[model samples]
Target: MKPASKSPSLKCLFLVAALAVWPLPAALAQPQGESFSGYLQTVAAKARREGISETAITRTLSGLTPNQRVIELDSAQPGSQGGPPPMAPYIARHVGPSIVSRGRGRHAELSGVIRKVEARYGVPGPVLLAIWGHETNYGSYVGDFDLARSLATLAWEGRRRDLFEGELIALLKMVDRGVPSYKLKGSWAGAFGYPQFLPSVYLRLAVDGDGDGHADIFSSPSDTLASIANYFRDAGWRQGQPWGVRASVPSGFNVGAYSTRLTAPRCERVHERHSRWKSVSEWRALGVAPMAPIGGDVLASLFQPDGPGTPAYLLTGNYRVILQYNCSNYYALSVGLLADEIAR
Candidate 1:
């Protein structure tokens, strides 16, 4: 039985060849240029089976056409370019004085409602304001693309068909829930509302902040705050902990030695920049001192964003929560710093 055993190299080559010829699933086998008309019919059938109403489905999906602009925007996401720009410049621009000032003003303006949201959800008010400020400039704008059309276009584009198709279905459900179709406008990628939430997120987490019996995140600041806080809380934000702290590392400390071996299941690139988790006391023993107070027992990861001799931070679990909102080091850091500035 062992007479015809293959060499290891030959086996490896055979495996590679097999993988190269492996059959894709039927769903993926469909051509990228598959007719949008057929795709819509399939999606509409699925929606009907899922109990979405006829009026809702017709209102949103009937005669919907793919948006070329949405396709352009999705294809042009920042990650498609070369490696990300330097983090310091990114931080400078995003967390600059203007956002800080606006965030502080919004903090004061929304203090009472922010307090109520924080009391219920345990997320900090300034953090909420920072997110609001960053997402839509404190409700100055919330994009203008029709969400139904955008979702349908992205779905028909077939690059991320499953995701956009599901989102399209969720949009139909939102319509069924009495949300008017005309109000469904947002980013080219389909996030809408003051909090820039996708349809599924609005269904799951959006809350009525002012007890108006409607979670009108589009125009109501109170609903926006509550909805955002609910998102943070669901993402596991901890109370009474700073997202991170400015830290100073010792001379000749080998940050490379501390690079994490563990891989994240999602947002792997964003997670790669973080050093392995260590207790604050352990980092202190290694001469990594926090410029501000943090509990010695708290577990934190070192992030030398610009490398040694530059600004470093010891980030906590709350920082990870911020990353959950938007999976970028630059974005999370900006939000945390902006929040601190607003609170200060």
Candidate 2:
């Protein structure tokens, strides 16, 4: 047997040199490196040792160029000044008559699959429909980036290496398990299919609702709904409870005393919009009544998304479950409101 060749010591040295001499625009250039070729070969060898097939490796990596846009977007976190528009403005723009009309139409079209999903998962069909509407605008805009290429590029960039590396590996595993590369396209951030699931999420929660061998979220509404239901179930969705309801806040309601003293474990921004958890009875005593009736023994929290003076809400645990989807109060609230509308 041949002795193993000693690995090169200064792997990053050439990269550093390339960065120093290369102009900014040139650095953003397409694939152009014999040195990078060596690195990739070494990586391929390691992957092969770990049981990844040569064919899979070659196919997964063929024609991959470092995506400059991904690098730029990953580095540029949205600043406070340039952050998303306020809730009202954003709602006006995105949740208007046209969107609602289209959503209602889609809701009618997918009613059968939605009903089956809801029956199986105990989540309301309209609620799932509302989320589908909000996330991808009823499948009208599910992004257009190649999931593997984007994730691989982000993984190799070394800035958010840990995060994207995991996603890249998951993407490879997805291919290895038989998801066609052509069907693996999604958002620039690697969120894919009708429900915009991350690669890890797809592995864990994707379902073949139509009883086919594969979970085709890209094209199958049944699979998409089932996958979403599975996601919500995994995220602790409670059966037979309302997520939340809009309510009128009474006069002289003390906003100061209603604030949460502790931070939530996840989706802090969404939870921050809510007051500390209190029983529905306590809330009712404080002149907060649900605009819609809630049945059975449902534990609820009080929330005023636009502070105390505006409309308040009585939120159940299911509302927090919705937060797991997007981690935004506006998103959860909109889903709830839209579901109510659709149900009505």
Candidate 3:
């Protein structure tokens, strides 16, 4: 009989190949000393494979080097080192009087266009303004980083390679579509324009609200508002429904019994603080009455961020939709509260 074969089985071979190319976890240090030029070559090859125009790749990627500032900013992002800061303080800073005043002014100033967009997309005008106000302070400062350099540097850093790499490719495709190079400036994280959209988001949802046939979110307030409405609509913002309402929780009610057992795949920590979904009437029976009107049968979750005697809320599905935009309770709540203030 022949000796047993030494070659590995097909399944073993496949597993070995997979392991060779698998990515390291974000917590682990990336392999060092890879040439940035060589990394760009691979990205260019990917662009070509994805059918990005050679002219676009050559024009945008040529002579580009990794941005050290982008790497520095990325490293400084908040992680698991400490407990989160208080929501009361964050809300005070982000949704302060200045933002509220500006938000109402913009709401009134753009009322005509806002009405049109709201009619088309089923998103409220004040909600759109709230997002705009929060994103870039109503376009006062939309960052000044070169998006190509920022995206490439972040990708090269390898902490979030797949995400930033895909964004870089999308940026090249934007170039292919004739967006000017100078217009490709935004946050150090590659989000650009008045709405602070990533390249992919711009490609997918940006629309021309002014009938110019060009979706210029960089300088056009109408386009920015319209694009934000489109994003909210896509995220399932329910028209004619409130995002949430403040609640009066009884002193003896055990909020902990209603804590959500389901873990969210993304932003699990943020979602963990939310109570289980219950109908508005059911919550009313439990002595958690909404201060403002909400439909009796509507499903909502309870959020009591600061414990007893602090402000509480009954959040609707629209609140979850807002979370999809930024994934922070403080952000979503501030947006809702800001929208209410602007509407008033």
Q: TM-score for all predictions?
A: 0.89, 0.83, 0.90
Write down the lDDT of every candidate, Cα atoms only: 0.84, 0.73, 0.86
Question: lDDT, candidate 3, residue 236?
Answer: 91
Pairs clashing within candidate 1: none
Tens digits of per-residue lDDT for model 1 on 1-344? 01222223554344433323333334432337556656776787788678776666666776566677777788787664567667898888888888899888888888899888999999999999999988998988999999988998788788888998989999888888888877899999999988899998998899899987999999999999999999999999989889999999987888889999999999999998899999999999999999887899999999988877888999999999999989989999999988989999
Per residue, candidate 3 scores C-alpha lDDT tens digits across 1-344 of: 11222344565444433423433334433435556666777887788777776666766776676777788899998887776667788778888889999998998899999999999999999998998988989999999999998998899888899999999999988887778998999999999988899998888889999999988999999999999999999989998889999999999788999999899899998888899999999999999999998999889999988787888999999999889888889889999999998888
Ten-residue region with minimum lDDT total, candidate 3: 1-10
Residue 135, candidate 3: Cα error in Å is: 0.7
CA-RMSD of model 1: 13.1
User: In model 2, which runs have C-alpha deviations exceeding 4 angstroms?
Assistant: 1-25, 29-50, 80-85
Candidate with the larger TM-score of 1 and 2:
1
Q: For each candidate in turn, give its C-alpha RMSD to the true structure in angstroms.
A: 13.1, 6.6, 10.2
Give a tens-digit lDDT track for model 2, residues 22-114.
Answer: 223447533333333343444555555555544555666654666788777777866546434446555456567766777677778888877
Cα-based lDDT at residue 282, candidate 1: 97
Q: Which ten residues in a row have the lowest lDDT in candidate 1?
A: 1-10
- lDDT for model 2: 0.73
TM-score of 1: 0.89
